[model samples]
Target chain A: MERLKSILLAEDNHMDVELTLEALGRHNLANEVEVVNDGAEALEYLYRRGKFSSRPAGNPAVVLLDIKMPKVNGLEVLKEIKGDPNLKMMPVVVLTSSREESDLIRSYNLGVNAYVVKPLEFEEFVTAVSRLGVFWAIINEPPPGSSRGIA
Target chain B: MRMDSIRSILLAEDNQMDVELTLEALGQHIFANDVVVVGDGAEALDYLRRNGKYADRQEGNPAVVLLDLKMPKVDGLKVLKEIKGDVSLRTIPVVVLTSSREEKDLVKSYQLGVNAYVVKPVDFHDFVEAVSKLDVFWAIVNEPPPARVNAG
Candidate 1:
């Protein structure tokens, strides 16, 4: 049986994480999300190293990355992913509160698949995240070799 | 003028039926009327670069480009390469909306820096739903790059 691919969400703020998960939960996709607090843990999860060792062998369907995080930041993580050929094809979307043009420009320049600014209003934010989840996790076909199911 | 407010979608599709279906699907959204459809990859590039027949068209890039793989001239992959390689156009989002589910096509598109890859659903209802969802995400949810005035 083919297992649904998972979405990796790298966010530091507990409130944002809960909100995002809640938004995705509205689409029955909350279970598909794997949360990581910072960029370092995100990398570890992707690389299947450190604490994430022996977790899985394939890349996640998509990564919902936050720009500002403790330890390694989102841009650095994006650079690392896009620069590395094996992981480059894996889709990464920047989900941040930053509406700064520089951040938008840099994310696209770094080869991010998409950039979505978290809406300031509560309802708008939920709608945005839900739409984003549905698009990336369901509508978009992830790259080859992405995680299919549990071993 | 604030170009970001202009949420135009460029569709490069050779198939007339597919084009109609895409337009129809996109019609469900407010930005539906903003779509600019081109029949082939050459026209796609022309529309993007503001060359040939499109020389006097516009100065800003579309919010996103929905590209079809097979075409009479240039083809979608070539068009994607040109867009991603050019500094001024690289930031513009490009999504491959093709019928082909071949692994090579998927790999090639991602390698060429396509923002997303979506397979055209076979069923009519599914196709419409997919496109509508895609439209909402790219046009409304996602933040497009700051508009750059193309210098000719």
Candidate 2:
């Protein structure tokens, strides 16, 4: 049996988080999403340190990270992830409401896998994320289909 | 308005045979795009950066980047790093379309933050069809990041 791929989602806003989870519910793919409220927590989840120390270790197929956060922020988190020799290939899609040039600039500079502008319209946002779900989870092949964990 | 923005695709590949096959497959698409090819990774970077030789390139960004691995000089991995590292170039949605699926390469490319990793079909005909389908899907549907003038 195939294991369900994990999705690392780093979002600070509760409302947006709920809405995104709901949107993902519409998809047929039941990806196990590890939700982190901020960039710091997101990093922790990826590295599996702190509370995540006890959790299983395997990289997510893709990461959906938001730009605005209290601690490290998306760009900083992106740099840490991309710069890491072991974790760099994990696909990270920037799903954020920030249209700020600085945010975009920094994210690209840090090598975010994809940068998606969260649509102001709920429907548009839903559609965009749905495509993301299909493409990343269903269509795109992960790193060689190996059963090896992130470690 | 957004859909109209994607007018062309610039495929940076070093091999001439690959160049021929990719162009032939692109012919299957409904959308008409100028699929420009640069022979090597260095040339590819120059075209994208508008540096040295590619000084007079077009105005807009390609809808997507279809990158090949294991090229001479700069190589796909490095080019991918350069594109994703550059503030202006990162959002371009690079799909690593290559032959080598070494676990290290796969892990490294995704870690480097490639949008998609598609192993090219080894057979010539299969390769053409695969590349063609990639063009079709990205050209018609994928919403590429907008033109940003500031990325270096």
* Candidate No. with top DockQ: 1
DockQ of model 1, rounded to 2 decimals: 0.63
Least accurate stretch of 10 residues (summed lDDT) in model 1 chain A? Answer: A142-151
DockQ values of all predictions: 0.63, 0.25
Q: Which ranges in model 2 have alpha carbons more than 4 Å from their true place?
A: A1-5, A141-151, B1-4, B13-34, B38-46, B49-55, B59-63, B70-93, B107-115, B121-152
Find the candidate with the highest TM-score and give its number: 1
Per-residue accuracy of model 1 over B1-152 as CA lDDT, tens digit each: 13457668999999999889988998898664499999999999999989999999878888899999988888999999999889889889999999998999999999999999999999999999999999999888888887783322
Off by over 4 Å in 1: A1-5, A148-151, B1-3, B149-152
| Winner by lDDT | 1
lDDT of 1 by residue, A41-97 (tens): 999988888987777577888999999999999999999999998999999999998
Cα TM-score of candidate 1: 0.94
* Model 2: per-residue Cα lDDT over B1-152, one tens digit each: 25355556778777778778888888886777877787778988888888897688766667778888888988999999998787777778788877786889887887677878877778988787667656654665344556654655
